[model samples]
Target chain A: MARARSEERRAEIVRAALEVIAERGYRGASLGAVAERVGLTQQGLLHYFPTKEALLVAVLEERDRWDTSGGRDRERWRLDLMESLVEYNAMRPGIVQTFSALLGESVTEDHPARAFFTERYTQVRENMAEVLRAEFGDELPGGLTPERVAPLLTAVMDGLQYQWLLDPDAVDMGASFRDFLALLREDSKRSA
Target chain B: MARARSEERRAEIVRAALEVIAERGYRGASLGAVAERVGLTQQGLLHYFPTKEALLVAVLEERDRWDTSGGRDRERWRLDLMESLVEYNAMRPGIVQTFSALLGESVTEDHPARAFFTERYTQVRENMAEVLRAEFGDELPGGLTPERVAPLLTAVMDGLQYQWLLDPDAVDMGASFRDFLALLREDSKRSA
Candidate 1:
């Protein structure tokens, strides 16, 4: 029972940290503010997360956990499933905003989150390549290998997010993604 | 003579501000730090630009100036020219980093740079549409209008920048952009 309570408390603290970071950005968020949000003294918060950096890592991990839930098979991800993922993201603006903020900051050399995002992209590209290879053998219809196209796939997803976040009403990220997918399908048809 | 010298000093300050902002991100950058980089007191920097927001606007405008110089005709911009622009950007990492950082921050509702980027993208999309119409016609190869494809064009450019900045060794942003262009060309040929 004590262990379960501790786990719940840690999850609650991570949620509060996400809210604070989303509103003020990572650089602007403080441990004190997150502690207040969770009804803990700063010292109590530190007990849960030994430092601000630890709290940040915890928040990022929690976000990944939420995204990869439902035991969705990664190797079977298709265009429709990718669109569904984009739709799912549309429902969670706070999480997306927090992610964008950290991603933007992580480009700098010294950011604590830099290593996390770097590894994440490397993995994301590899996973995307695997999905493409499974769907299309060695070469996609455009004669490009999955390895060649994986970066573009990741680019479109992230790029669409930036535009959508800036002007959500104007940018239909899901539709735009579907359109790109259609282009890929069209290429396959022409080549075949 | 004094007026010319003052203009030169203003330009120099803008350059320094870009460096500081790129290194520290917008939230972490301070006017005092920027001033110190350019050998000015904070008061002296304020004398030139009364506020940090004003300085930020100046930095953004200066970047645009650098990008659009050389009198390359905008209405006549073709795929080849667009590719050239991407190549040019690869040569200037500092400027690209500053622009990316501001763009990421401006996604937040209240950032001072928000209006500038929003307006810039709106104009950019329109310009891209014009370029496509000139190069292709009423319809691109895939049957979508140029207006429909403009945002994706912009998205790919910005997205490639993010990935390239994160891992320059692994990502060739220019080559990836060219590959996207090739896909568009293939679409055109099939439609033809």
Candidate 2:
């Protein structure tokens, strides 16, 4: 019961932090605002989070948990399912904004989240390569290696997000992503 | 001569602001830090830029001016020239980091730069579509309209930068972009 209660409190705190960050941005957000939402003093929050950077880290990890924690098979997403992931992302603009905001901010000089993103991209690339390998074998029909193609796949998904966020009505994130998948298939027709 | 001197002073301040934003990030960057870099008091800097938001807008516009302000025809870039542009971007990681960092942060709530990026992307997409229409004529071999494909081209460029920033050595930005260019051509081959 004690352990479960601690986990629940942590979850509430993370949710509160996300709301604050989403509203005020990471730089504008205050630990006080987050703690207040959860009915704790800033010092009390620090007992759990230790530092502002630690809280940021926890928020990012929790986001990934929400994204990938759907179930066991969710981790091993296929190409088609990846398209669905994009579709799912379209439904939740607020969450997508927060995640993208974090990603964009974290890439700069000595950001606490920079290392986290670097490692995540590394793993994401490796996982994408495996997905390509399983579906298309060692090399795609056009003789491109799975390792080589994985990054492009990742890039399109990310690139479309920026465009979609800027103008959702103009750029249908899911349809555009499907179009990209169609383009990917165009290569095989020529090679075959 | 006095007007020219003032223009030069503004340029110097903008450059200083860029360096500070790059090093400290946009969120962490301050007018005081920027002023200190260019030998101005905070009050003096305010005389030039009435607000921090104005300074940020000036920084972003300066970046575009550096990119597209090369002359008259620089604005009307062709598809092949775009490849050169990508190559050019690869050589300037600091500028790219600053631009991307701002872009990511601006996507969230009430960022001063959000409207700037939204308008810029609107212009960028329309420009990209024109480039595609000129080269491929309405649509490429895949029958995908230029309007539909414009976002993908932009997405590829933006997406690749994030990957390259995270791990430059592991991902050769230029070569991968060339590969994407090659993929774009694959569709034409089938249609032709």
TM, every model: 0.86, 0.86
Model 2 misplaced stretches (Cα beyond 4 Å): A1-8, A15-30, A51-53, A70-76, A141-143, A188-192, B1-8, B16-30, B36-38, B51-53, B70-76, B190-192
Candidate with the greatest lDDT versus the true structure? 2
Q: Whole-model lDDT, candidate 1?
A: 0.79
Candidate 2 local lDDT, B91-129, one digit each (tens): 777767777777897786677888998998898888888
Indicate which candidate wins on DockQ. 2
What is the Cα-based lDDT of residue B22 in candidate 1? 62
Tens-digit lDDT string for candidate 2 (A1-192): 999999899989999988887676656557888899999999999988887767877887887766666535744568887888899989777667766766787777777778888888898888888888877778663456888888888888888898788788878999988877776676555557
Whole-model lDDT per candidate:
0.79, 0.79
Query: What docking grade applies to model 2?
Result: medium
Interface DockQ of each model:
0.44, 0.53
What would the per-residue lDDT of candidate 1 be over residues A1-192, giving only the tens digit for each residue? 999999999999999998887677655668999999999999999989987867877898888767666526764466567788888888767667667766776776577877887888888888788877877678664567888788888888888888888788888888888777766676556567
Report the C-alpha displacement of residue A77, candidate 2, in angstroms. Answer: 0.6
As for candidate 2, its clashing pairs are none
Per-residue lDDT for B93 in model 1?
A: 76
